[model samples]
Each structure stands twice: as structure tokens, then as C-alpha cells.
Target: MLSAYLLVSHGSRDPRPEIALQQLTELINQKQQSYSSSKKLVGLAYLETRPEPLHIQIKEFAHHAVLAGCDSLKIIPLFLLPGVHVMQEIPEEVALAQQAVGKDFNLELLPYIGSNPGLTKLLSQQMAEIITQAWVLIAHGSRRPGFQQPVETIAANIGAVAAYWSVAPSLEAQVEQLVAAGKEKIAILPYFLFAGGITDAIAQLTETLKLKFPAVTFQLAQPLGASAELADLIWDLMKE
Candidate 1:
């Protein structure tokens, strides 16, 4: 009985997230190879942008996995926050997939990638190399009331203020607050796994922020891309 692991993400139309996910998939596969045999399976799935919904994707992947001798499967959500998708949608999809897959199959939904404390530590390490008096930890925010808690917690852990891309306490607002607090050198870390349209928009916003706050210095860090370090995190998420 083989155990197959599938990394699921909020799908994108830009193609970059998909590319990064595939790279991550490869990295996880490489790590899996190191600790285990060549018999296991590692794959990628999406919650959107495909013709099929997530449950269907999970079902199809599980079907393929079973054919490849996989009896048990773990679905790991690659999300960075415990947003609506993580707290509600993904688990619902997993349950639907579990129901459809039936008795003999073992389909378990693992905790999301963002739920790991190691993630904040990784973010801290990323900022350690950059010189800044203060930091703004930004993410694509959720409309869900308590979703900002994780972002705030991570920011607090890293000695930074929190900002959201699509919600209140935006990057502009955060920068203004820092500038008002006498911070001259500030850095912004994108709390994402890869560079996407939102990251580009954040870069543009930084350019605008620089013009707005000419006296205050600003630096923007890359999102946690598909590096071995991130792969190591994903590898840790999957016990297979």
C-alpha cells in the first residue's frame, strides 16, 4: 500500500504560481527520494482555475494514485493563512472527496502550510539578511474577521507591523504608520510563496510609496519562492 501526497494551492491564471507549484512538487519529490524509496508519489492540485473543482481534482488524483498502488493519500493545502479557503472551503472539498472515494481509501486533510510556526521562522531568516530599521509583513488579506490574526502574529514575531493587500491596514497605511513612528529605513516582506500579480502590484505600490515618502527609505523582499528551504517546509508537512 503506497502513500501519495498532493500539494494543493489556490490556483492562478497567471501561470507563475502553477510553475512554482510544479518546482515545489519536484523539490518535495527530491526530498521524498532522499528519505524513502522510489515507490511513493508526489503531485500538485488546485482549488481554482481548472475545469474541475478541487474535490474533482482530488478525486481524479486519488484515482490515479490508487492505480499507481497508492492506498492512502494526504492532501496538503499550500495556503499561507487560515483564511476562508483554509478554514472552510478546502476541508469541505476534502470531505466530499473522502466520501466519494469510499471505504478502502484513506484520504486525510493535513494542516495547512501556514499553520506551521517554522513558516514565521523562515520569514524572520529572510529578513535577517536585509538591513532595515523596521518591517511591514504583508499578505493578501482575507475578508474573514479573524484571518488577519496569523498575519499579525507573524509580524509581531518578526518585529514588524502587519499589512494586507486587499483589506484594511494596507501597505500604504502600514508605511504611513511606520514613517510617523520615526522609521526611516523600512523593509516590506511579501508573505507569499511565489511572485505573482499581487507581488508585482506590491512592487508598484512600493514605488508609489517611495515617491510619497521621499524622506523615508523603503525596501521590498521577495516572496518565499520555490527554494529548497521552502521545499524543506513542504517536505516536513508530508510524512510520506
Candidate 2:
């Protein structure tokens, strides 16, 4: 049987994030072995930071699978949502890759991580465990209005748990709303991996808000790193 797995994520030059992806792939492979199916798992990062763009990445992986005599390839996008990159850009790239590798290569793009209600529940539970007061689930907000629904869904699903007063918004809007509401204690949970420009900007914004809402305290939680639950989620996707 010709079969292989590819776990694709947003590429980062930072070694830490890339390393985490590698770890996630290893976990997937480990789980697959329990079912007596042995297939090579490859992890690819898509961005200029990496040598391969999405097209090249998928094609190269497909070529490797073909050479290895595998007939099927499954791609799992590690993004949090089905954004423009996931919906338009990645699919187009995959189509090109499929043509380049050969029509015979069976390839599939799995759903984005954020689409899973299980993962959303986990995110909400994680936030609830950490925050005893009002907080914002900070995400990489998009100007595209369509991008907001996934975040809204996650927030609503999380709210269903009734753990704490939680809201989802761009960092700026969240901060502003919290201050206006006279909330004294607040926290921000970054919905991203790795600290970068956006996280830094949120920090700066939070500092200013702290002074303005002196009664409100702020804390930032670490981004969801590679964890067993994530590893499980990947396995669940691949099984489907």
C-alpha cells in the first residue's frame, strides 16, 4: 500500500516553532503504529522563511512518497482556521503540486485545526483554568470579516462551559472594551504560537491599558505549544 502523511504548518524562521512541528509529526507517527500501520510522516513549513513555498513543499513531499512507492498522501494543515491562506492559497498550491507529482498520487487536504469543536473546547477549558477574572482570547484578528466567524464560534463554544467571563476580539478592541467596562482584573490569552510582532504590539497596548485601567491587572498566557491533545487531534483527523 502506498501511503504517507504530511503535516503542514505556517513556517517560522524561529527554530523553536519549527521544532515543535517536528515533534507533532513524531507523535502522529507513533499513534499510527498502534494500529499496525506504518507510514512515513513528513512535516513541512510553508513560507519564505523556509526554502520551499507551499507548492514546492507539497510537490517535493509527493515526489518523495512516489519514489518510496506510496500511492496516497494526506495533508493536514496546522492552521487555527480556514482563512484565506487555507481556503484559497493552499488549495491552489495543492492543485499545482498534485499535477506536478502525477495524477495518480492520491492527495487530500484535511480540515484546519480550528474547525474541530473538540479543539475549541480544549482552548476554552485551558483559558478557564488559567483565568479567574474577565479575559480576552487574543487572536491574530483579520481585516477580512469572514475570518471572524471561526474565532466567534470558538468563543461561543468556550462560553458554553460557563467558566469565566470571556470574550474574543482583536487585542486592541478587547483591551478597549475591558477598560470601558471598568474591569479591574484581566488577562490576555494569545491565540498564536511564538512571540512575534503582533504579540509584541499587544504587549505594548496592554501596558498602556494597564495605566488607564489601573484597577485592572493583566497577564499573558503562553501560546498553545505542542501538546498530547494536539497530537491526538492530528491522529483523529488522519483516521478520518
Global Cα lDDT for candidate 2: 0.69
**Over all chains combined, what TM-score does candidate 2 have?**
0.84
> lDDT per model, in order?
0.88, 0.69
Q: Which pairs of residues have clashing backbones in candidate 1? A: none
**What digit string (tens of lDDT, one per residue) describes model 2 on residues 195-228?**
5656666778778777777777787666677777
Worst 10 residues of 1 by lDDT: 31-40
lDDT measured at residue 62 in model 2 versus the true structure, 0 to 100: 82
Residues 1-240, model 1: lDDT tens digits? 577988899998998988888888888778878886655687788888989999999999999999999888898899988888888999999999999999799898898998887888888889998999999999898888788888888888889898999999898988888888899999999999899999999999999999999998889999999988888887777754
Clashes of each: 0, 3
